[model samples]
Target chain A: MDIPSYQDMLAAHERIRPHIRLTPVLQSDHLNALSGARLFFKCENLQEPGAFKVRGATNAVFSLDRDRAAAGVATHSSGNHALCLSYAAGLRGIPCNVVMPHTAPEAKKDAVRRYGGTITECEPSTSSREETFARVQARTGSEFVHPYNDPRVIAGQGTCAKELIEQTGGLDIVTAPIGGGGMISGTCLTLAKLAPDTQVIAAEPEQADDAYRSFKAGQLIADDAPQTVADGLKVPLKDLTWHFVSNHVSDILTVSEQEIVDAMRLGWKYLRLVIEPSSAVPLAAILKNAERFKDKRVGVIITGGNVDLDRLPWTEGA
Target chain B: MDIPSYQDMLAAHERIRPHIRLTPVLQSDHLNALSGARLFFKCENLQEPGAFKVRGATNAVFSLDRDRAAAGVATHSSGNHALCLSYAAGLRGIPCNVVMPHTAPEAKKDAVRRYGGTITECEPSTSSREETFARVQARTGSEFVHPYNDPRVIAGQGTCAKELIEQTGGLDIVTAPIGGGGMISGTCLTLAKLAPDTQVIAAEPEQADDAYRSFKAGQLIADDAPQTVADGLKVPLKDLTWHFVSNHVSDILTVSEQEIVDAMRLGWKYLRLVIEPSSAVPLAAILKNAERFKDKRVGVIITGGNVDLDRLPWTEGA
Candidate 1:
């Protein structure tokens, strides 16, 4: 697959404009003071599918050729991507198939089904999901829509940064949690051209820091099954995402599990935003590395809100 | 104090616009499908203080004359109003003294202290609160900004509906939880003049349904210490609020505690909004009286989001 051009992001925006919400940017003076940064939250948590994955999913589902569309779309995701693709396919009246780990949050699985996606459960690991997804795609003869890594998906995800840049003024740095680097890649793909002065930074959970390790080692690294409170961020970076991360991203930061939980609670209290654990990684990083972000105008992407409300990260059992 | 005029609301908007967030509206197709109506959620829960009360609070605080502002402002509230008033006072660099029931959420108390408000605890009853507030107000010589009844406060709250009308296509009906009838009165204040055709409705928790009783009986009734999960809706309508409710509001609907909890969960799930139980009452009312809202465009006000993250209503201990 070829790298998506600047025009691809623009085209994706126009194509998906009618389908998605132009979610609002949220800010808190309390958060700014706590971290000593003027923080702008790109609340994709309020996105139509409750995540930014809809940007890529909708773009891919709609971009499919008429013949290719007939076969429907399929993917393997930790959670948001599956639900998003299903939501997009449901809009186009097409079938969707997803391979999710059996340990995936019940809320996400329920959402996938609610959006008419059929889910196949696999062991909670990257390798297992890929193996399961291959069989499902082969059996169904469906178009394979990777959760990240694809040029089309990356282009679609890039639209979020376009809106973010359009929504805010002169952002010094843009940060997002690095799961498979889909959102960070999108931020890079957009800012590298649209706002060349803006820096792209990726935050990752300490437990799932494959992207950070890869950045330091100067090679791609894949983690099979890293355990972390941020369930949606357990996966590792792919080739497409790595290309952008390696080229455009300024730095990658990792936060401890406790920091992720702390930031999640702070986001809930100060921002009063229903953000998922994975989404808190950026804020956690900012708070832990205060010197790096202090006094800078930073845009933080709240990646998703598809949390199992019954199981908050800070709760005892959870 | 006199009834707030349309010009009062317009002026309040201008005065408080800089201090508040023009919070976004949220919608969910699942919620629309469930209730069989086109629903627009005016997300005041995303307001700067995590509630719509900030609108009235800021207006009241900022509208005070120099002499009055010097002494600062004080109010008696269940939760949001106190925190919001404290927040507004903090912004204006003035002292704020609040009378809050001991039963108000811990989150709210923490927030009030965080914003530099001095909280004096009272018994968990409106009479007890007012009695304590009177002594506190007389001692501090602070301007008393009634949580809802003051014309300035009502006018300020009215701006929410104005924004709602501007943000969405024509709404056939507007609904809000009726505590002291502040928000509902504000809606009436705006829609009565701005969108004369739009019907205003009030929702209440059955455990504290004084507003519903007052609207049905054509007289104000006070419920001193009614208890419900929606802590913010425990108060009764005052004379000024009754004036608007009697003249402009078309109906008052009450929902069971279970319905409020169910709707709160649904709001969290579908809207992906961090809403308090008081915010859910409007949705609960609509869901309970589905046929009343069917085939019509309804604007539901999510009043506040000052909820204790640990004690979600659906959870066992909560």
Candidate 2:
């Protein structure tokens, strides 16, 4: 994998600027009062298509040649990535075929449909998703936009960090949730070039800490059956993303599911912002290890706000 | 009642600048797409003490003389106002007494306690609340800050519309929820002076449409038994408030309980912001009568985001 540079990230920001929202970097007075850190939240949860997925999806869609673009786009996602790609494709007047699992949330499905995306449901398994996507690609000859593993997507994701640095100067540390590590990889690359002094930390839930274990052990670790409130961080670390993380990121930390739930509730109660469990990963990390980051300037990437409103994490507990 | 002009609102902005947040004006791309009117939300729900009640409370607290302020403050409220006053008083190193009904939500009671407020729980009736507040004031010699009846509070609330107008650049119309008419009075006063072309409309839940009825009948109308999701709009229009609403407010529209529920859910889902039923009134009114404001630049004031998260309005069907 050719690692995208800061120059590439700057270009991605320019490319996706028209399609994506430069979501506000909210300064949390309440959180700051609690932790004694000047925390800036990169609210990607409020981004277009309801996630930072748009940054990557939009970059991928526009990166393709005119003929390839005219041929349309396709992806396999049961979450924000699916909705984002669909929305991005619609903006560009290109067809979007989202192959989602049958068990995908009704809200997510409705969002994709509302954005004018054509959906094809398959079994809720990696093998089934791949097979369904291949079949759809073969039938339509459309380009497949990998959710996180692709270089173009990773470069696009880096644009989030680019904006963060531009908005809040040089940060002491930057943290983001790690699944397949697309967001963190892009974040690392952007920080490595722009503010090398700023430590890039991978915040992973303990239920699915494959990325943390892999980074710590100096080897890729795959989870057969991972579990966590942060559904977006369920995916295992890939080779390309691990390469970026290993080289650029300073450390990786894990937080409990309970901490994630608490952080989500705290965000709503204090920030009045409805953040999904996935978006709460960075906050969970901060709350769990407040000592390490006290009095430092920190930036937390809130990845998305697409939660199952019917079954919130807090209610399931006490 | 002395009418607050745009100049008074400007002064109020300067006075409350240190205490209040210049809450962001957020846009719901999805809602705008669905409703046809380009809707811009003034996010006062994200204000301190978890509501715009702080704006009025803070203004009132600071407007007092140092000697009068040393005597501390007192108010009767079910939740937000009490919490706001307590928080503001705590910040100013002064004492606060809150006269709350025992029937108020546990969360609000907890918040008032968290801010070091002395709670005086009374029966859930106007007579009881008034009697309890007066007794507390007589005993403690604390200054009374009426939630909506105070001109300083109205001036402070009007600063929201002042900020909204500055943020959105003279909206076609400004819609705010009306209870005691503090926010709407401030909004109307600001709009009437600064942007006379911009209409100011009051939104009320049909279950407690005292303000709406009064606006139409040209007389203060208090519902004998008002029942609505919006607990904040339970208060009837006072004489001073009624005068402002009657003179300056363009119209007062009523929305059903279902609309309020739907708007609250939509706010949580789309805007990723936790808004209470009272905050949803403006959005509810917008949905109920979208045809009236079609293709217009509409500004809706989100009154507050404090809600009982354990049992969300979204889960409890309309």
Q: Which ten residues in a row have the lowest lDDT in candidate 2 chain A?
A: A223-232
Tens-digit lDDT track for model 1 on B50-76?
999999999999998889899999999
Q: Per-residue lDDT tens digits of candidate 2, residues B1-318?
A: 576566767787888899888888888888997788999988987786788888878888887889999999999986788888998888888999999989777778888898889999998777788888889999999999888888877888888888898999879989999988988988887888888999998999998888888888888877643777788888777876877898899999999998998888888889988898899989889888989789999999998887888867666642
lDDT of 1 by residue, A1-318 (tens): 477877899999999999999988899888999999999999998887899999999999999998999899999999999999999999999999999999999999999999999999999988898899899999999999989888888899999999999999669999999988888888898998999999998999989999999999989988889999998899989888999999999999999999999999999888878899999999999999999999999999999999998888788575
Alpha-carbon DockQ of candidate 1: 0.74
Docking class of 2: medium
- On a 0 to 100 scale, what is the lDDT of residue A206 in model 2? 94
Candidate 2 lDDT, tens digit per residue, A98-119? 9988877777888899889999
Cα displacement (angstroms), candidate 2, residue B128, comes to 1.5
Clashes of each: 0, 0
TM-score of 2: 0.97
List fnat, each candidate. Answer: 0.60, 0.69
Model 2 whole-model lDDT (C-alpha atoms): 0.86
